[model samples]
Target: MRFIFLVLLALSIALGLGGWSAHWALDQSAEIGTVTIGPWVANPSAGAPDADPYSKARLAKIGNLTLGLGEGVQFTADRDAAGRPLRRECQYRLAGQTPAARVWTIAPYSQEGRLIQPGSGRVAWLTSNNLMRAEDNSFAIAVGPRARAGNWLATAGTGPLVLSLSLYDTPVSAASGVANVELPELTLESCPDA
Candidate 1:
């Protein structure tokens, strides 16, 4: 009876610790090296040898090919500038001067990391080569489930979505030591029902 009790106690402790460790590993958001601007966050070391364990795990989970360090930086926004979670129920306007880069692209993706497909003639992404810029070089793109006049990114379903912006061969540095690089602005426009 004494041996059985000890074995049971040891098993309980092991199971408890295992559960806690899995929880932490799955939900850990404290990326070792990341740059945040407004709602967008970029991790420059995603594919590098020095990447953190969390980043490696996340990359494996997402199954995304990370760009090289000089090749580009990718930014993802799951929230709005007002600290509100980004939902497909609302429309948003993304406008601003992008950082210095050879090329860039922005796309709307569902929570599962798949591209959101809305309707015909409405693309899910905008590339730097195809954008219609103003005289001063600033650009605006509308993101919604419905069609808009200019530069619209279609969101197929309702619920939370993320906007991913990738800047290729950008002069902007993603290192933690660098400071004050300009990123695009995402503003909540309106919600018809909510």
Candidate 2:
């Protein structure tokens, strides 16, 4: 009877630990196959055929259509330069030059992965072709609930927000790992609530 009880206790401990570990792995926001550059994080291998089990599970759970290895890489930022969580009530500026790419897009989305629609007649996303660049080719985009003078990306409602920067037909995708690429910096401009 003593030996049987000991075996049962060991089995229970093993099962409990196993279940906890599996849950922790699946719940991680930044999985193993990911690269972080500044405030942006990208899992280049998430869409590859040989992606790890965790990467595949994360993609499946999020229901995101990831860019293929040869297509491009999509970087996501949920925080500002100071590492504060991005909130819709605050204003921000995305300023910098992107890595080499045939085309790139910057858009705002809710934490649930849905696009955040702005007021009618206003653009909620910006593309590389239509932006006004500085003399040196750098660009600045204003993001907030209110409208700005130039290169504006508007958001609506109040909640946590995310920024998605998708680079298409870029050399970054062809590389095995992320190179020293410069991505835009998201700086908090203002917040009425704060």
Candidate 3:
């Protein structure tokens, strides 16, 4: 009887642990084939055929199409360079030199993966063609509630902010086995409550 009870208890514990692990694997923090640069993270195999089960599950749960290996790569940032959570009430300056890509785009989205609506007549995204370059060939984009003159990503939503940078037709995907690519710098400028 003692032997049987111990076996049952161990089985129950194993099952519980398995269930919990599955749940956690589907959470927001769950990612496979990911690379981190500062506050940004890139899942180069997000849309690849060899994607792990967690990445496949995440992509299916989000219901969004990811770029394929030859298509491009996407990097997401949920915090600033100072390691502070990005908030809609705060302004940020995203500046840096991007890697070699035919075209790129930066956009702000809510935590739910929905694109934040831009202000009246203003865009919520910046494309490679419309970006302004500094003397050193670095670019900057403003992000906040208020509209700015240069490239801007309007944070008109009411939730935590997330920035997505997409590089189209770039040689940075996982298939190429290239890592440590140059990304942008996300600096917190100011905040209304600050």
Q: What are the models' TM-scores?
A: 0.85, 0.86, 0.84
lDDT of 2 by residue, 117-152 (tens): 887898889999999999999999999998889899
lDDT of 1: 0.83
Between prediction 1 and prediction 3, the one with superior TM-score is 1
Worst 10 residues of 3 by lDDT: 171-180
Looking at model 3, residue 44 earns an lDDT score of: 86
Error of 2 at 89 (Å): 1.3
Model number with the top lDDT = 2
The order of the candidates by TM-score, greatest first, is 2, 1, 3
Q: Write candidate 1's Cα lDDT for 49-112 as tens digits.
A: 7777888777777787887777888889999889888888789999999988899999988777
In angstroms, give how far residue 101 of model 3 lies from its true place.
0.3
Give the worst 10-residue stretch by lDDT in candidate 1. Answer: 171-180
Clash statistics: count for each candidate: 0, 0, 0
